[model samples]
Target chain A: MNALNLLRIAVKALQRNKLRAFLTMLGIIIGVAAVITMMSIGEGSRRSIESNLTSMGSNMITISPSSNSPGVRMSGSSIQSLTVNDVIALRNQATNLTAVSPMVSASGQVIKGALNWSTSIQGASPEYLDIRKLEVSEGISFDESDVRSSAKVCLLGKTVIDNLFPNGENPVGQIIRFNKIPFQVIGVLASKGQSGFGQDQDDIIIAPYTTVQNRVLASTYFQSIFTSAISEAASEAASEEITRILRETHRLRATEENDFSVRTQAELINTLNTTMGMLTALLTSVASISLVIGGIGIMNIMYVSVTERTREIGLRMSIGARPVDILMQFLIEAILISITGGVIGVIIGVSASVLVSGILNWPTVISEPSIVISFLVCALTGVFFGYYPAQKASRLDPIEALRYE
Target chain B: MSKILEIHDLKREFKVGSEIVRALKGVSFDVGTGEFITIMGTSGSGKSTLLNVLGCLDKPSSGTYLLDGVDLKSLNRNQLAQFRNTKIGFVFQAYNLLPRTSALENVELPLLYNPSINTKERRERAIQALEAVKLADRFDHTPNQLSGGQQQRVAIARALVNEPVMILADEATGNLDTRTSYEIMSLMQELNQVQKKTIVFVTHEPDIASFSSRTIMLRDGKVQKDTPNENLQSAREALNSLPVTEDY
Candidate 1:
């Protein structure tokens, strides 16, 4: 028989038990929806992280002194191996280096006209703002002359400004006390919102490294060295050059391990992306189990249908339907159910992803290739599970089937 | 008249758990075109097995059976299906009409297996067959909506829809009352007489067998008697004489 006619017959048969058919399709629907939702969530998070990383400066790299002892645990920036001399050496030797700054961070209470807030204070050169992609919204950043003179001028991040100066007052040229030391606010840094780890990115104050080293924390050694590449594409080359320079300047023997660790933003992004990708794959695999279960449900229903319609099959055979015709009829019925389910699943999956994004405030990306792949999988599920039952129907002896009560 | 079917020494055996059961034992028969014949037997008399072989639903264990000019053994499974589609029609005891399907679509079923016929022709032929069976007005009715006699008529229309060489009916009137049985028999008689249709009917009822031109009585997997009826009864006259019951 022609495919159209066969399909019609199959539809008619399914129409006899609409509830059963719908229930059978529900399994596939849930399976496809789960897969799509998980994949979209993963894609969305990856994209979100990538954008955050780029905004934070994709080519930025951090060099921190490693822990000195083998058994003792120490904070990353506690070691005093990296210093301003290494930053100068990296700036001079690294080919693709655009900006190099020595960083020293300390948390302290800052007070402006009786408004007090505790915030992190970062001390670095004027180029630190450029390396960290921090733009000044008002006033000016501390210049190199300010760094050399140990000027007590600082830039306030938006969060810190809001907390320390709450009266909608621009803090430029205002004096704020950090650890009982008065410092003039040079500028208000632009808002960077939250980082990928949910930490507030705009809750800090930046000052010249010389002032922070001599006046605030009274530190002699630099905590970390931050550098930026000329372009994101050149960050890897810049990292290699910085490693060679730091190794030679630190005078580490060729056979000995280096006392510093250099990490590029690209590495962090790659690691996060890999983690997100793995999560998506794990979720998708779990969802595919449902599709398999759905296929089994179809097979179970098909087996029952074959048994219930044995006499009908016999009657058709007696009339003129070949074994292959019977097989095709049942197989096509299965495919029709699954394909319909798959289409509905795609719709539900997209909607569910949208709903999740809206309600939970999570990012979601609906990919077209995933939809196409799920459809193909649904078709395969139909054929794979429907085969045995259809084959059983086809192999039935007409005489015995006709005799079936 | 040319013989429509010929069977010589046909044997059919079944293995029931290592025990051989011979369903048909060396039965031989020839049926001419336009002939109305009845094969009568009790349950387990092998009439059903013979009918299956005749309908090409089963192959005889050992025999030289021919339908028209083609050897039944020479045809493959697919060819046999085609042969059944084009050359034979079957009527079952339960009517075998698909539930929830319209009478017209049920009749169009046989034509579906015939790829040579298009959709429009299939519909037209089905309507014509239903019209021939006097069910044109009930074309859209399902089997549940029709009476037993009407359902049987629809089944007969389905059998005739493909314009087969012969109609094979197994207990066609077995589910009907006397009047309904008589009504179906009358319809068959009309088709045989006016349309020159070949018919082979199987039944256990001797009264039903009286309407045919010839009767073959089978017992214990063999034909006990094969004789031509000298005086064939008219089912129309029989229906007229019977008392009418309330329409179902």
Candidate 2:
């Protein structure tokens, strides 16, 4: 028989078992939905990190003390050569330096009216806020003079303010003690909660580097050093300048390896993108196991259908249909089921992904290629898995099959 | 008379396990133009196998079979299907109509297999065939909804829709009551005689065999007897002597 007749016959057969057909379609639906949803989640997480990194200026670079920066791991004590003098040198000498800030952090308890918070203490100059693109919410930030004269002033992060002052009372100009020394709150840093590392990003207080060094903690070594390039085109030059300045300030003689490493925000973005892309691919692949299982289900059901309709097959064959005719009929039936299911699956998968993104408040984009590929894969699966049963139906002996109960 | 179908020394065998089971041993027959011939046999006598072979559903193990002067053995699979579509029709014991299709659509099946007939022509021919079988009013009724005799008539309509040279009936009335069976047999008889269409029916009942003009009996895959039904006149006289059954 021709293709039209075969398709008509197949559609009629499928309609006869509507419930079974729908149940089989459900498997493909769930598989496709899971695949799309997982990929969207992974994409959402990556976008979250991207926006976070973007909010902190993309032209920024970080310079930290390192040892040789080669195959061998750096011993923590061996990489402490970075200093404030290096920051001053880069700011003055580098042609593309926009702003330079030397960072030093101290984790200590702050006390006020029985409300205490073990908050991170960040020490930097007023230039830190401009380069890092932070805005003071309620009070002014510290200036260069404060850093030079070791002013007894502080800036509280949003989380620290909330934790220590539960009544939402303003703490600007109010005296709070850190490490048993009293310092007035000079500013309130802007809120930047939940960094890419899942850490509470705004849980800190800021102070002048000299004040932190002299009164808050007597620490000779500092945390990561920070700087910013003048423009997107100038980030590379600025990073190199920081490395050169730090190397010279530390007085690393000839035949000695530089102890500091400089990295750009663009480099961090690339690394993160590659890692998250791999994660997305892995998750999507894991979800494909369900699609394979759905293919197996189609194969199993087709075999039973062929067996059940053996007598009908015999009758058709005897009328005029050839073996190839019979084969095409059943194969077309299988493909119709799978292709219809795949179309429904694509719609359901995309919708479910959107639903998940909406509920979780995450960014997600479903690519068109994913939908097209899903359709092709599922239809081809029907051909591969449904082949054996359709062949069995075609190859049946008419004389014997007609006698089959 | 012009011969429409001729089978010469047809033999068929099957490999059942390690042994060869001989189903037909050189069975030979000829069907003339508009002939109604019945082949009678007991169980395991290979009459059904002969019907399948004649319908191009099976390949004879050896020997030649010709329908409308085209050697069936020489035709490829596709060619045989075309031949079956245009030149041969089959009516089986169980009324093997597609249960889901309406009687009209079931009758249109063979026309669909032949592309020369377009949709409009196919539908018209199907309606005409249904009318010939006296089921025109019930064209939309499915096979399951029709009674056993009506179902058989619908099957005959499906078989006749292609307007083939011959209608091969294999126990066409086997599943019906005596009255319904007679109704179906009368329909077959009308097609063979008034329509001048050749027919080959396979049955075990003597009364059914008497309806045909000739009889061929088979025993153990060979023809036991081949003779014209000279007693058909007496059988008709005796039938009229009995009683008037339902008109149906």
Best by TM-score: 1
Q: TM-score of each candidate?
A: 0.96, 0.85
Residue B184's lDDT within candidate 2 is 74
Worst 10 residues of 1 chain A by lDDT: A67-76
Candidate 2 runs further than 4 Å off: A57-59, A67-79, A92-98, A109-117, A138-154, A163-187, A214-222, A229-245, A248-255, A263-286, A347-373, B13-28, B43-45, B116-122, B219-226, B229-248
Residue lDDT tens for model 1, B218-246: 99999999999899999999999986658
DockQ of each: 0.76, 0.46
Steric clashes per prediction: 0, 2
* Highest DockQ against the true fold, candidate: 1
Model 1 lDDT tens row, A272-374: 9999989889989999999999999999999999999999998888888888999999999899889999999999999999999999999999999889999
Give i-RMS (Å) per prediction.
1.0, 2.2
Model 1 regions lying over 4 Å from their true place? A68-74, B245-248
What lDDT does each candidate get? Answer: 0.91, 0.82
